[model samples]
Target: MVDGAIAGAVGSAALNVVSYLDVAVRARPTSSTPEETVGRLAGLAHVDLGPEDRAANRRSGLGAVLGYAVGIGAGAVLGALAGTRRMPLAVGTALLGGATMATTDASLAVLRISDPRTWRRSDWMADLVPHLAYGMAAAATLNRLRPPSARCG
Candidate 1:
């Protein structure tokens, strides 16, 4: 149970680190204008937007991190309670984390705050890597707590 809790915490930490990396990458200058950079990042992350949206994406990204913290907390509690049934906890937590990000990004878009339309492939590529890394870490960490009966080995 202790191990499961630790693993869950580690998984959440991994997600946080990856998210931070994504932010750092986006902070770097690209061909994108300042106004477009935020919106472009939101688009790359699959968040929809409109002219009336005024939410600050960078701040929302911070909120995404907070949401990840909640997901991790939930996962750790579930993992500890479920013991050998960690796989579901892990998968659920991972999905929750993703959903949190999508929600946060979308909310910001609703307020009209976004990146420039000229977001480059390189910028998006940099962002993609961190998200993938975070997902992998989350999966691996949660796998440790999965029951033998789970589909995963």
Candidate 2:
């Protein structure tokens, strides 16, 4: 559990770094999907967040925080699973990336917030690259932490 938590933190940091770098390089606006998803969920749950102006800002902040939480949580879960039976580095990385992407994309689709099918090639690349980085970092960290005996197939 401790190893997983540590790996998750590292993975979350990697994801954040990649995201910031992408923004710096492209000067692109951050995606609003998170905020929109959060808002939709809130509405469904009938959870009032107070004043309209404050609520909007709060939701946006919460959305970003939630994204980080998901990344960390996913890493932890993956780490725990890998502890029992380790996967090859490449396979683990790909699975982690896919898992992370699916979590976000699934939530958006379920809430009718965004359709990935409509995304431009550039948008897809933007989302994919950082996630791949996150997966690699998390998987590598977990792999390194595993006992040598456990690492072998």
Candidate 3:
């Protein structure tokens, strides 16, 4: 569990770094979908976030928090499932990336924040690159933390 969470944090960092680099290179504005998702969720829960400005601030922070929760949760799940067993790196990374991407995309679609079907090629690329980085980092970290008695793929 601890290993999973640590791997998740590392994965999240990689995702963020790649995302930031993409933004820097493309000069694109950051996505507000995360914050929008936060607002929609809060509305559903009937939790008032105070004033307009305050609510916006809260959403921003919570959006980021939600991201971390997902990352760490994904990692924890991975650890539980993998245990001493390891998947081939190619297989593992794709599974991890696809799983994370699905979770995020599904959540956003469910919240009516964004429609995957409508995303542009560039948009997909922007999302995919960072997520792949996440998978690579998280999978590698988990493998490294495994005992030398690690199970063969």
What TM-scores do the predictions have? 0.44, 0.90, 0.96
Can you rank all candidates by TM-score, best first? 3, 2, 1
Tell me the TM-score of model 3. Answer: 0.96
Per-residue accuracy of model 3 over 1-153 as CA lDDT, tens digit each: 778888888898899899999889999998898899899999999999999999999999999998888888898898888877766667768877889999999998998899999999999999999999999898888888887667664
Pick by lDDT: 1 or 2, better one:
2
Cα RMSD to the true fold for all candidates: 9.1, 1.6, 1.1
Error of 1 at 27 (Å): 8.3
Candidate 3 CA-lDDT value? 0.88
Tens digits of per-residue lDDT for model 2 on 5-102? 67667777888799889998999888888789778988999998779999989899989888888888888888777764556878877988889988
Steric clash count of candidate 2: 0
Number of clashes in model 1? Answer: 14
Candidate 3: list runs displaced more than 4 Å. none
Off by over 4 Å in 1: 1-9, 19-67, 70-101, 115-118
Clashes of each: 14, 0, 0
- Candidate 1 overall Cα lDDT vs. reference? 0.52
